[model samples]
Target: MNEDLTFLVLRQLQANPKQTQLQLSQAIGISVGRTNYVVRALIERGLLKAEHFRNSKNKSAYAYLLTPEGIDTKARITARFIQRKRAEYDALRAELDQLTAEAEAEGLLPQ
Candidate 1:
């Protein structure tokens, strides 16, 4: 999975470990199958732990918990994600400003 998806999964799980795969998929705007794949990959990487809900009658129900390493990874990923988004935002703001200036110069927009 990409860093953005990974960060999102970790974040969602951290917020609510008991969320079903479908819920997670909806939250992340990904297919349930893709979510399953990502979850399995995270588990294999030792970043996440999936434990069955013993009290629940649904044997398939599980709680996805983040390992310590997963928490650290999430923090790092979050920082990178924020940095990338900030750069994108700055670029977009500059572009918008330039567009506004051109529009004003062309009398297409009021000053």
Candidate 2:
């Protein structure tokens, strides 16, 4: 799975382990197949542990619990994501300020 999708799956799984693949697909805005594929990959990587829940309403239902490693990965991914967003926001803010100055210089914007 791609980095963006991997991060999202981890986040969604951490939020609710009981969420079905269909529910996760809808929440992540991806296809069920893709969601399954990603989850399988995570399981293979030892990040997520899928266990069947007999006491649950759905007999075939499973919970995707995060391992200790998975939690650490999530924290790292979250920090990186926040940093990337901050950089993007700073760049956009600077561009907007420049555009606003130009507009004001041209009298297109009220001073």
In candidate 1, stretches whose alpha carbon ends up further than 4 angstroms from where it belongs are none
- In candidate 2, the residue pairs with backbone N, CA or C atoms under 3 Å apart (3 or more residues apart, or in different chains) clash, namely none
lDDT of 2 by residue, 1-111 (tens): 676788899999999999999999999999999899999999999899999997887777999999999999889988888898899999999999999999999999999
Local lDDT at 91 for model 1: 100
List the global CA lDDT of all models: 0.98, 0.93
Worst lDDT 10-window in candidate 2: 1-10
Every model's TM-score: 0.97, 0.91
Number of the top candidate by TM-score?
1
Q: Write the per-residue lDDT of candidate 1 for residues 1-111, one digit (tens) a residue.
A: 699999999999999999999999999999999999999999999999999998999999999999999999999999999999999999999999999999999999999
TM-score, predicted candidate 2 vs. hidden true structure: 0.91
Name the lDDT of candidate 2. 0.93
Give the residue spans of candidate 2 off by over 4 A: none
- Candidates' RMSD to native: 0.7, 1.3
